[model samples]
Target chain A: MSAQISFRNLTLGYERHPAVHHLSGEVKQGALLAICGANGAGKSTLLKGIGGALKPLGGSIDRHGLDPREIAYLPQGAEIDRSFPIHVYDMVSMGLWRRAGLFGGIGRADRTKIEHAIAAVGLEGFETRPIGTLSGGQMQRTLFARLLLQDARVILLDEPFTALDAKTVSDLVDLVRRWHGEKRTVIAVLHDFDLVRATFPETLLLARTPVAWGPTAEALGPENLLKARRLGESWRDDALPCSDAA
Target chain B: MSLFDTFFAPFAEFEFMRRALAGVFALSLGAGPVGAFLMLRRMSLTGDAMAHAILPGAAIGFLFAGLNLYAMTAGGLAAGLLVAVGAGVVARATGMKEDASLAAFYLISLALGVLIVSLRGSNVDLLHVLFGTVLGIDDATLMLIAGITTVTLLTLAVVWRPLVLECVDPTFLASVSRSGGVSHIAFLSLVVLNLVGGFHALGTLLSVGLMMLPAATARFFVRDLTALVTTSTLIAFGSGVAGLLVSYHLGTPSGPSIILVAGLAYAGAVILGPIGGLAGRFVPRRHLEA
Candidate 1:
């Protein structure tokens, strides 16, 4: 597969301390990859960097030709205001923003597409309901519907299955598989090793630095897992700045 | 016959009353939706701060031009925009939150404005700037209010989709479109423009009252933003007419009367509105059969 995204010595962080430190890797087109890491493992940070939400503090992320907006990114614990007075249909339709744009009314075709997307996510009857009234899982489903409408070549899911019920998780996972079947690059930050092993062909283990990268089985080897655990991501504020970070 | 005279006569018998009614009507039309948007953004306090931020600019205009409508409008617009844009800039550059920066700017603005107004003008002039004369509104001021209202409503319509998207799911909007920040800045500019328009009749202190009170009142009654904006505008409009009549009869201050009417509606909505008002909270409802 040709490289869709290539990171060259990328360093991403808040303030000056690097959370995703000295990473060099490539996400090939159609690669189904899992990013496994501890709580502060810079998994979300890396996703943000690639999703264009966060600018790289150092190095470069070469996306070849993909526009950052074209990459559908789902951040964990979505930054949406739940109390915002928007209906599910309206919220889901916003996924077509890349195409419809500002002042571009959702045409009949777009409405049909939105309805299909909503039904796909099992939110058919709840289209008119306000998003504020939705439960956590239902809200997640709504967002997934939006993601489905995004129609991007690359999809990044940060802790996609967090706090979801078993049924919901399985359904969302099937959707992810559907995206994979379409030959789209799917990168997910996952905690469930079982799910990763079963679904993902490739894995990148991070611990403020790369622990291992390659085939899921090898990358998540017991020794590498132990090394990742030992390389705790806590910041030592007084520690001298690393010269190689540049 | 007397009842008709009480309400209709005041509006018909005198031109000033007619102008005041027209001024407040235009204000209600524009300020209502603008205020509703402000409330939705959870920037109600930001609206208040911006109102004060415009005071000094308007005051400076008063100092130089002596109550010239155009000069004060321009000054107030400049000042309000400066604070709004300045607060946003400071928050972005220095990592300080926008609210903190806004509060800082507005305090300075409010104090400086009062000082400037008091420097040359008498206590009555100071009072006039602080609490405007809705009844004394002239043709030029009426035109200013109407013009600002027209601009505000048109702009609101043009930016409605992006503006709503910007408020609801800003993160998603940012990922999908570049209109997030543009809509935000546009919304802020509208807020300042409405305040500048309102201050001419309601004064800086009470101007935001028209913008915020009706919006706040409408929240209890509606769940959808469209409904909220419409309801708020109607409430503002109702308050404008009612307050003018009350002022016409009671000899009370018109600006305060208008705001007080809005405040009353807000309080009543909080207690009685069906959505989430205290009464609804206490009153038991039949459970939804799943």
Candidate 2:
């Protein structure tokens, strides 16, 4: 499989402190990967680096030729104002924004596509309802519908199933599987080991740096998990200044 | 007094009153929606700050051109934008909050503006700039207000979706489009532009009152952006008419009267509106069966 994203010694951080420390890895095209780690393991930061929301502190993230707009990224807790007065349909229609643009009104075909995406998430009746009024499950489903319309080659989901019911998780996981089956790259920051093991073919364990990167079964060994837990606890405030080549 | 005589006769009797109504209407048509967005973005107070931010420039313009409309408008726009951009840059570079930076800058701007105005003009002239003379609006002021309204409405039409998307989900837009930062800066500029426009008729202090009061009023009764903007505009225009009539009948300051009317509407919405009104709590309906 072709390398969809090649990270060459990428060091992403904030204010000179590395959130995702010096790391190098490639996510192959059409690979479904799970990034698993403890709290503050830089999973979301790594996803942000790929999504181009955060610039790498040192090295480059090579997306080959994928435009930033061509990547569908859902951040953890998604900085969305729940009280914003937007209808579910209007919010879903924003998925086609890459094609529709600022002034391009949604055409009849686009409208149908939005409706179909909404229905696929089983939110058909909630089209006109304000997104604020929806339950967390319904909101997640709405986001999944938006992901469906995005049709990106690479999909990055940051804890997409957090606090969601089992049913909603299964339904969204199915969508992730569908994307994987369609030869699209899907990277998710997931905590649930069972879901990660069952759905994700590749796993990258992170603890501010890469702990393991390989097949799910091998990378998630008990020893590796213990080491990751240890590494997470050892965050040093007076750590040696990062050498450029490190 | 009949309805026709009470409502329509004031304007028929005075050209100044007609011009004032026209100016306020145009202002309501533009600033109302702009204010609605400001309130939605939770930058309602930012609009208030920006109003003061434009003061030094307008005062400097007054000092230079002796109340020349174009000079004052240009000067105010420049000052407002300067404070807005400066505050943003300061907040980002120095790690201070934007509101903190803005408050500091606008305070300085306000003091400088008052000093400048007082250097060249009498207390009456200062009062004119501070409180405005809406009933004494010239043709040039009318045209300027109308032109600002037109530009604002047209710009809103073009940037509506991105603006809304930007407000609700800033991170999402960044992933999908590179226009996220651009939209935010553009929205900030629009707020400044509308504030400057409002300054022409309502003056520095009372200008933002028109923008924010109606928006707050609309918020109580409306749930969607379109409805929020529409209702705010209607409320603002209605306040303009009613307030102008009240000012005419009772001989009050037109600017304050208009703002007071909008404030009354806001209070009314809070007390009486159906969505989340105070009255609804006292007069309860049975819970919905979901």
lDDT tens string, model 2, A63-111?
A: 9999877999887655898888899998888899888888887889998
TM-score of each: 0.96, 0.96
lDDT of 1 by residue, A1-246 (tens): 899999999999988889999999999999999999899999999998998988888899999999999999887756788888889998898889888776677889999999999999898899989999998889999999999999999999989898999999999999999999999999999999999999999999999899999999999999999999999877878877879866
The runs of at least 3 residues in candidate 1 whose Cα sits more than 4 Å from the true structure, single-residue gaps closed, are B1-3, B114-124
In terms of DockQ, the best-performing candidate is: 2
Q: What does fnat come to for each candidate?
A: 0.71, 0.84
Tens-digit lDDT string for candidate 2 (B1-290): 89878889999999999999999999999988899889888888999789778878887877787888888889889988888888877886687987899899889888887776677665425465678888989999899889888988998887788889888887888898877656666677878887777777778889898889999988888788799999999999999889899999999989999999999999999999888899999997899997
lDDT of 2 at B29: 96
- Provide the global lDDT of candidate 1 against the true structure: 0.89
Q: Measured by TM-score, how close is model 1 to the native structure?
A: 0.96
The collision pairs in model 2 are none
Error of 1 at B184 (Å): 1.8
